[model samples]
Target: MLARNDQNSLRRTPLYGLHVSLGGKMVPFAGYEMPVQYPAGVLKEHLHTRTAAGLFDVSHMGQIALRPKSGRVEDAAKALERLVPQDIMALAPGRQRYAQFTNEDGGILDDLMVANFGDHLFLVVNAACKAEDEAHLRAHLSDDCTIDSLADRALIALQGPKAEFVLAKFCAEAPSMKFMDAGPHKVDGIECFVSRSGYTGEDGFEISVPAGDAERLAKALLENSDVLPIGLGARDSLRLEAGLCLYGHDIDTTTTPVEAALEWSVQKSRRTGGARAGGFPGAEKILSQFDQGASRRRVGLRAEGRAPVREGAPLFADATSGEPIGKVTSGGFGPSLNAPVAMGYVPTAQSALGTQLFAEVRGQRLALQVAAMPFVKNTYKR
Candidate 1:
C-alpha cells in the first residue's frame, strides 16, 4: 500500500522539477524524490511505455567500479567472481549479467547488475543496500581487486517500443546492439555507457552518464513526444507484469536465488569452475537447493475478481479454512490485463500451474489461480 503523501529524506534527481512541471506525482522511493506517476496515471503510463517510450530516473541506484590490481579484464573478472555466483570470466566484453551479493547463510544481501567494462566491472546495486554491499565486497575481495563507489554517475532508463529509436538520436551505433550488450558512447556530447537492457520487458537502454550532464541528457530524450517521463508507480507495475523481482519487496537476505526462481543467473561453468568457481558465502546450501529442490518457489497468480490484491496479502490453501501457504510480494491492477494480478511464493506442492490459492484481501479470500509468469507478452526486439 503506497501513501499518496511524500516521505523522502533523500535528494532529488536532476529531472525532479521537469517531472513536476509535466504533472508527475512525486513520491519518495529508495531515499530519492521520484515520480510515481504522471498526468497520464499508472495505466496510461504502463501502456504508453509498452507502445511507445518511457524515461525513468533510476539514478537512486548505487553505481560502483571494481578495478583489478592487475588492471586486466580477464584477471579482474576472476577475482570478482569469488564474491558472486555468475561466471564473469566467460562474460563477453560489452555484456552484462544479473547477480546477487550473498551472505554466509546462502541469503541474498542484494541483487545487482554487473557489466564487464573491458578493464573494470561496472556494478549497479540497490541504493538502500549499497553501503552494506560495498562493505561486504571490500571485506572479502582479494587484494587483487579494488572496489570504489561512483558517486558522480546518474542512471537513466529509456524503455519501451520506441526506445531504440529515441536512443538513436544520441548514439548512431546503438540500434544494432542486442539486449544486455553495453558500450561506451556519447549521448548529446555527454560520454556515457549504454546498455540495451531494462526491467520493463521491453527493448530499452540503461544509460550511465556523468551526474553533471544527466539533466541535459534527460531533456534531450524527452524532446521526442514518443518518450515520456514515467514514474515509480508505473515502473513497479511494469516490472511486476514482466515477472522481474524487486529487491527488498520480492527478495531479501533470507531468500536464495534458487528459491526465488533466479537460477538462470548462475552459469553451469561457474558452478564447476577453476579460479572463478561458485565459492561465495553459503555456496553449500545454495548448491544443495539447486540439486535437491527448494521448499517454496516464486510464482505468478491471477485473481478471480476485479479487486486488486496488494503486497503483504496473505495466501491460503483454499477459500475456506487452510493454513497460510505464502504471501504476495508484488500485486496490482495490471494495465495490460485490465484485471488484478499478483506474484508471490508458495509451497512447492501448491506451485504447479493452475493450482488454486486464496488471497486474503479486505477480510475476504479471493480465489487466485497459478499462472505462467509475464502476465503480459514481452515485446523485446529479440
Candidate 2:
C-alpha cells in the first residue's frame, strides 16, 4: 500500500473536497492524498461498516477497458488469458473474477479484478502497479484488443450489511446483484459500473462512475443515515480482518500464488490435462506446485496478547530459538474481533490450524498461534 511518490507529487481524487469537508484526516497513500480516517476515527468507522454502511473513495485504483477487435468478449478474454492464470474465456458477462498477473517465475506481479462486460473486458488493478500494468497490457495484448484506460472514472465502495438497502434506494438493480456481479447500471441517476464485491468481507457495491459525477454520487450515498465516510485506515483493517492480501505486503513479485495460499483462485481449466492449460506465465512451475506442494504457505496468526504483531516481525518455530522460521507480512488489531490478528508465510508443516509459533516484536518473542482466517466472518451476498 506504499508508493515512492513524494508529498509534492501526490495526486488527489475527485472526492478530495468531500473528504476534507467531512473532517477526514488526509494522508499520503499509494501516491495519492487520501483520507486515513474521518472525524469518527478508525475504530468507529470500522465498526460502523460492520453494523451499518461505510463509503470509501477508491478512485486511486487503475481502471482499464479492453475492446476486442473482433467485437466479441471471448476474443478479449482469450487475449487476457496470456497474462493471468484465471480462466478468463469462461467468465460470464456481468461476472468478475479475482486474478493475478504473474511473472515467468510464477511470482505475482499484481492481483486484480477482471469483469466481463459483454462487448469488452474491464479491469481494476492496484494503484501503485497501475502504470506498469497498463504498459504490460499494451505491450502484450494490444494486437487483439483496443486497450483504453478509464482515467475519467472515479470508484467508490459502499460496504456493509446495510449497503444493499442503502444502494437499492437509488438503483433498483442493486439487490439483484450477487457477489462478483459487475456491469453498467444507473446509480442515483448517474451512470456507473456497479459491482457486488468489495475489499472488506461485507455485502457491498463498488460504483465506478464518471469523475464529474463522483462527488454527486458520493454525496447521495453519504446522505443516507446508515452511511458514513470511511478512509484508508478502516479499509486496511477491514480487509486484514477479512484475511485479504494487500498487494505489496501479503503478495508480491517475490511470492507465487501457490505459496501465498491463493491456489483456489487458479481455475481447473488452467491446470494440467485441461483444455488450453499452462499457456500463461509461470505455468510450468505453478502447475508443478499444485501437486508438489510449496515449502511455505501463508497462514493466519493469532497473537497471545493485546499488543499487535506488526509486519516485518520475524517468526520462529520455538519461543527461544534464535533462528527465524518465517515473517509476518500483514498484522494489526482487528476491530471486529477485538484482538490482534496477522497473516504471514510459515513452513507447510507449521501452517496447520493449531500450530504454535512466535513473533519477534520490539526485541521480544511473543507467542502466536496459527489460526483460522477471516478473523471476522464474511457476509457476502451469496
**Top of the candidates by lDDT:** 2
Cand. 2 Cα-lDDT: 0.94
**CA error at residue 89 for candidate 1, angstroms:** 1.0
Error of 1 at 103 (Å): 1.2
lDDT of 2 at 95: 99
User: CA lDDT of each candidate?
Assistant: 0.86, 0.94
Model 2 clashing residue pairs (backbone): none
Every candidate's CA RMSD: 3.2, 2.2
Query: How far does residue 54 in candidate 1 sit from its true spot (Å)?
Result: 0.5
Q: Where's the lowest-lDDT run of ten residues in candidate 1?
A: 1-10
- Candidate 2 residues lying further than 4 Å off, grouped into runs, are 1-7
